[model samples]
Target: MCSWMVSSYFGSILYSEMPFNVEIKAKVSNASQLAEKASQLSQSEGTVIHQQDTFFNCSLGRLKLRDLMDGNGQLIFYERPDCGGPKLSNYSISNTPDPEGLRAVLADALGVKGKVKKERRLFLVGQTRVHLDTVEGLGHFMELEVVLKEDQSLEEGEVIARSLMKDLGVREDSLVTGAYMDLLLEAQG
Candidate 1:
C-alpha cells in the first residue's frame, strides 16, 4: 500500500496580498502514462521543468525558494488545508533573478527545513495546471492547481478541479495533502 503525509503547520500560511486557488495533490502510479493521456486531451504539449525547492523554517507559513534550472526563481509563501483531498490554497509569489543570493539570505535568517528536487511535466487545461512529478527519493506524484480569478468562486474552482481529476485518471483514494517539502520532513521523522 502507498503511504501518505498530512500538511505541516507551516503549510497553512498564505499572504493576504496574493491569489487563492483550489489545489489538489495526488500520488500517481504511472506518471508517464498520465502525461501521455493529458497530452492527448490538453490544449498543448506540456513543458518540462527541473526545479529545486529549498524550504525554510518559519513560524507562520510555508516558505520556499524555488530555483528552476533556467536560472529563474520564485520565493513562494503559501497556506492551505492539510487534509487528504482537493482543498483551498492561498499563496504569494515573488520572482527573483538571483536565487543563490536569496537562498543564502533566507538560510541565514531562517534555517533550512529541507529541499525537494523534481522533474515536472506541467500541462495546462484551462486555468488549471496538471503536474506530473518525479521527485528525488520520494518517487512520482501529481498536482492540480486551479487558479481562481477575482471573479471566480472557490466552488467553481473545486468543480473544475474535480472534473480535471477525473479526466486525468487521478484516483481520489490516492490524494495527498501538503507540499513536497512536508513529505520529505515527514519521512525524516
Candidate 2:
C-alpha cells in the first residue's frame, strides 16, 4: 500500500553544484597522464570521476535512501528517482569533504534543525530498459555520490565528495536523502 504522509512538520534538503559537473571519460596511457588531464583546468582544479550508480539491481525504476552528514547549510540528501516539499529554495556551491570523524566533530561545531520527514517515494523515471532520467523534485539531483576517481586512490572519490560537500554547504550530520517511495507517496493525490 502507498501512503502520502505530509510529515507532521516538514523536512527539506539544500544543495548545489560546482560547475555543471563536467563529465569526462577519456583513455589515458597511465595514472600520470590521467592526473595531468583530470586536474588540468584553465582556472579551476578538476578531477576524473566514474559514477558507480547504486540505483537498483534490476527493476527499471529503482532508487534508494541514505543518511547524510551535515556541512555549511542545514541539509542532507542523496539521489532518488523522485522527491518533494514546499520547495522553499534551490542552488549550488563549491563543496568540501568530511573525514570519518567529521560527523562527531560536527556535533560540537554545527547545529541541526527541524525533524526528519518520514516519507514514501515513487520513482517514475523509466519503465523498461534504456537509461534516461526524468527525475522529480525538479530536473534531477546529485546527492551522496561517490566521486569515483579522486587523486590516484580508489576511495579518493568519496573523500573528494566529502570535501566538496563541506566546502559547498552540506552539513555533516543529516539524512543524505530520503526514500523516493516516501516522497512520491506524499505527492500522490
Candidate 3:
C-alpha cells in the first residue's frame, strides 16, 4: 500500500463564490493498479455516521503518523456520504488535530462558521469508506472514493482527481464546484 498524508477543507460559499476551508494531509499513494480497479470495490454498503457540531478551532500541531504540515490554511470538511452526486451531507468531525494542528488553528483564524450533520452510511471499499447523506431538508447525496495516488506530482494528482470523477460518472452539471458545507449554508438561509 502507498500513502501520502492528504488533507483539505470543505468550505461554505458566499455570493455564489468560493467557500471557507483549511486542511493539510500528505496524499499517500495506495498501490498503483488501485485506480484501475476502482470498480471492483463498488459494492452496495451501509453505515450510520456521526458529526460533531462545527466550532472555532485555532491550534497548531502535527500528526504522529505521516508528513503533514499546516503551512497554509484550508477549510476543514466534515465527513460526507457518497451517493448520487457527492454526499451533500454526512457525518464528519472537522478540525482534526491531524499530527499538524492546521485545521483547528486556521478555522478559527478564517472566522467562518460551519454546521454539522450525521447519518447512516451505505458504502465501503476495502479500507476506504462510502456513505449516504441528506442535508436536513435540503438534499440527498452519495460519494465513493479510493485513496489518492501517493507522491504523485501536482499535475498527476489533478489528473487522477479529474479522471476518477469522470470514470465514476460524476456529471459536470451536478458537480457543485465547491464543498457541500458551503452549499448547505447557502441553502439554509
Using lDDT as the measure, which candidate wins? Answer: 1
Candidate 2 residue 77 C-alpha distance from true site, Å: 20
- lDDT for predicted candidate 1 compared with the true structure: 0.83
Over 52-83, each residue of candidate 1 has an lDDT whose tens digit, in order, gives: 99999988668999999778899998877578
What residue pairs clash in candidate 1, if any at all? 13-78
The deviation in Å at residue 172 for candidate 2 is 2.7
Worst 10 residues of 3 by lDDT: 19-28
Model 2 lDDT tens row, 19-119: 11111111112333322322331123432221211122222223221223332222133322222211111123323353224334443454322122222
Q: Residues 1-189, candidate 3: write the lDDT tens digits.
A: 011222222233212222211111111133123333443445443444543334342232111111113332223333322222222221222233442354355455654356445343444554334334454544554444333333334344334444545544444455442344545666777
lDDT of each: 0.83, 0.27, 0.36
Better of 1 and 2 by lDDT: 1
Task: Put the candidates in TM-score order, highest first.
Answer: 1, 3, 2
Q: Cα deviation in Å at residue 159, candidate 1?
A: 0.4
Off by over 4 Å in 1: 1-15
The TM-scores, one per candidate, come to 0.90, 0.25, 0.42
